[model samples]
Target chain A: MIEHYLSLSVLLFCLGVLGVISRRNVFVVFMSIELMLNAANLGFVAVARLHQSMDGHVLALMVMAVAAAEAALALAVVILLHKHKGNLDTNIFSLLKG
Target chain B: MFDVMVILPLAATGAGAILIMLVAAFETFRREGISILGMGLFAFAFFIQLTVDNSGDIYPFAEVFNGMLVANTFTKVAGLIILACGFFSALAAQTYFTQNKGFVLEFYCMLLFAAFGMLLLTMVAELITLFIALEIMSLAVYTLVGYDRHSVVRAEAVLKYLMLGAFAGAFYVMGAVLVYAGTGSTSFAAIGAVVADSGYLSNPALVGGSFLILFAFLFKAAAFPFHAWVIDVYDGAPLPVTAFMATAVKTSIFAVLANFLLINPEVHQGWVTFLFYLSILTMFAGNLIAIGQQNLKRMLAASGIVHTGYLLIALVALGSERFSGGAILFYLAAYGVATLGLFVALSYLSGQDERRVSFDDFRGLAKVRPYSAACIAIFLLSMAGIPPTAGFMGKFYIIAGAFQAGHAVLAVLGIVSSILSLWYYLRLIIVMYFREPEQRFEVAELTLAPLGTIVLAVCVFAISFYPVVL
Candidate 1:
């Protein structure tokens, strides 16, 4: 059971990384990052269960709070980018090179 | 009482941040008043931190809050550096906003918030505390970077930094979870105990977890392979914001890295070989990027990468034998002074929305404004690691530490990289003195950044002779 959960966690993390790398849309990239955090949350909970302690559960809660904060800022940035360039694609905002 | 004494500075900074935010809501604070208040708050914190004598009784609150925050001489000095950087950056921001519009009272609030986070970052001794503090600092910095919402450059910079920074943050959480899975505790002391008893390499989860955590740190520190984001992000932020990010952010990060690595000799030894190559590549790659840059801000940002490389050398030299925290802190102070000096000078000289930012823009500045030009030259030379300057002593201590650790090759490459860096540093000086003036060098006569520049230039010298008992 532990191995299965850990495998699922790793798979989700890799998918998040893939989404971040492949997607050019700003919102999608942020969602991917959120996915990555959730994957870590999964790992934290599973590890907590495996160890029979509540520390991982507490850590997962903290990570979720931080993720929410990051999501708020990311969405604000996405809105700002849209207002500036009239698009949500990351490639459209490339004024700074090198 | 000891706990309160240890946390007094942190409390003061937090209060100052909240006070400034509340004050920003009023109609009277205005731009100049808020900047001055910010400077005052930082100065207040610096003094508070300085007066709390922690040198003699090492670790006053060693087990406070479940061993999450430790206060030794190392964290004290790191906190001092961060506060001083904040004060000086606030000084520069005053002059920066004098000519450039888009000033808001909340800008100072964010500055204090970031400093508060960095203060926490330096003192964090637990994985969970480290994550929260890192987020606090990152979130504040992201807001500062994108503060100028209309600029496309700022937007791009914030997006890139936000994405990469969040990625790194997530990596840290994952690594923390893995290590928790392996060790059953999140505290540094507990983890060290575990690593010492079982050995660092015995557990697959711990090894993989530490690797990921180190990767996250290196990304934050702007080390090699994770360094490409630094130039653009630094260039994209406002001048004072960049200075704050350059000095305070890096100092806090290095402090945490040192603390993390100092947990156990076995753990550090396990990673020394990998860090050895990473330091070398960071230096050379930084030099290559810095050499090719035409924009002055981009070049400074790239040189910051080179400085990180040198700091990495000090980290490599730091074994479990003797604490090399003093060397790292001294180097950070020296680098902070010179880098902040250069940026403060640029803040006033860049003139009217920073139109003149490239290397060619400052041709023959020496002819028109001798004093300002000389100050910039001193900063550049100091950054180039010339004699009788703080940068020279910083490099000396780091290289000596490397040699003492028996990493002779890293020491030699460090010297080589310093020599390579001299070209760009001197190139700026040569352009200022040797070329013909392209435009009229304008200055805001009643500004504080120039005053800040002069003070930092003096610091570049005064900090050199600061005795480091390594």
Candidate 2:
């Protein structure tokens, strides 16, 4: 059961990584970032169960909170990008080539 | 009680930031008053930090917050450098805004807030605390980067910085989760104890987690593989603000990196080889990039990357056997003071709207404004690691530490890289003194910034003799 959960979490993480690297849309990229974060959240839950401790549970919750804060900021940035370039494509925001 | 002295500046800065926020809400008080108040608070913090002993790490805030934060010798020293950076940058900014005229009362508020976050970063001993402090610093900085919303370049820079920064933050949380899974705790003390007992390397989870965390830090510090964003962002930000980020932000990020690395040898050993190669690549890449840059701010930004490489060498050479990473701290001091001084000088000489930003623009600067040109020359030489200056001493200690720590090849590469760095460092000096004046460069009548520059130039040597300052 634990192995299944861990495997599922790993799969989700890989998918998120793939999405971030392969997708061109800024919204998709941000959503991929969120997917990666939640995948890690899943790992935290699985590891917590395996270790039989409350530490992972609290950590998972803490991550969700941080993720929420990050999403808030990311959305604001997306809006800013939309205003400047009139598109949400990651490649369009290449004014800073570094 | 003396231990508490080290963190007083941090406390004062935080309180000062809150006060500025309140002051910003009122229409009666002005930006000038807030700027002065902020500088005064930071100056007081600097003195407090300067007077503290440098022999050991003080745990003043250790118990107050359940040891989540430390006020050790390393931290106290780093905090002082950062506070001083803030104070001087404020001085430069005050004169800068006089000409540019986009005076927002909350600029001081955000500056103080960022300083507060940097101070907290200096002593953060827990992963969660480090994350929170890092965000506080980065968040405030993002606002400052976009402080001039009128400029499209500035806006673009902030967008780039924010996206990259938030992405790094996400990695930090993921790493923290993995480390927590392995160690049952996230505090540095717990991690250190576990690493000491079971050895940190054997634990794959801890190793992977630390890599993720360190990568995020490298991105923040703008190290070798992760350093691309620096040139553009530094180029776009307002001149005074570029100086602040170059000095204060780098100082704090490095302080925490040293702290994390010093906690356990097992952890340091686990990644020594990787760190060794990364340092070398960072140094060479930085030198190569800086050599090609024509714009003065972009050159300084690239040089900042080279400085990060040197700091990495120090990090690779640092050991957990000793309580203090003295070489790293000293080098940071020397580097911080010189960089801040140069930027302050630029803040004055860059003129309104920064009409002069390239190396050629400074042609015959020595003939036009010899004093400012000479001041800039001093900073450039110090950065080039010329002898008798603090930069020379800093490189000396770090290279010696690298050798002592058994990284002989790294030390040799460090020397070679320093020599390469001189190519660009000297380019500006030659432009200033060797050529005849092209632009009749009118220097700013900014009493505060010029004085700030001279003070920092003196500090390039004064900070070298730790006993005198401490």
Fnat per model, in the order shown: 0.87, 0.33
lDDT of 2 by residue, B1-470 (tens): 75466667777888888888887898887767777887887887788678766556555656675576777677877887788788888888887776675568888878888999999998898876787789889988888887674566777788778767877776776788678767877778788888888886678878778888878888999998889989989988888788899989999998998888787787677768888888898999988999999998899999999999999998888883332477777888788888888888887788888878899989999998888888888888899999888899888888877887878999999999999999999999999999999788776563588888888888877766663111
* Candidate 2 Cα outliers beyond 4 Å, as residue runs: A1-6, A45-62, B1-7, B50-66, B320-324, B467-470
Candidate maximizing lDDT:
1
Q: Which candidate is the best by DockQ?
A: 1
Candidate 1 local lDDT, B1-470, one digit each (tens): 77789878999999999999999999987887888899999999999999987664244456555666887788999999999999998998999988886677899889999999999999888898899999999999999999888788888899999999999998888889778988988888888899889987788888878988988999999999899999999999999999999999999999999887887787678778888999999999999999999999999999999999999999998863454788999999999999999999999999999888999999999999898999999988888899999999999999989988989999999999999999999998999999999788877778898888898988999999889988
- lDDT values for all models: 0.90, 0.81
Residue B319's lDDT in candidate 2: 80
| Candidate 1 global lDDT | 0.90
Off by over 4 Å in 1: B56-64, B320-323
TM-score of each: 0.98, 0.93
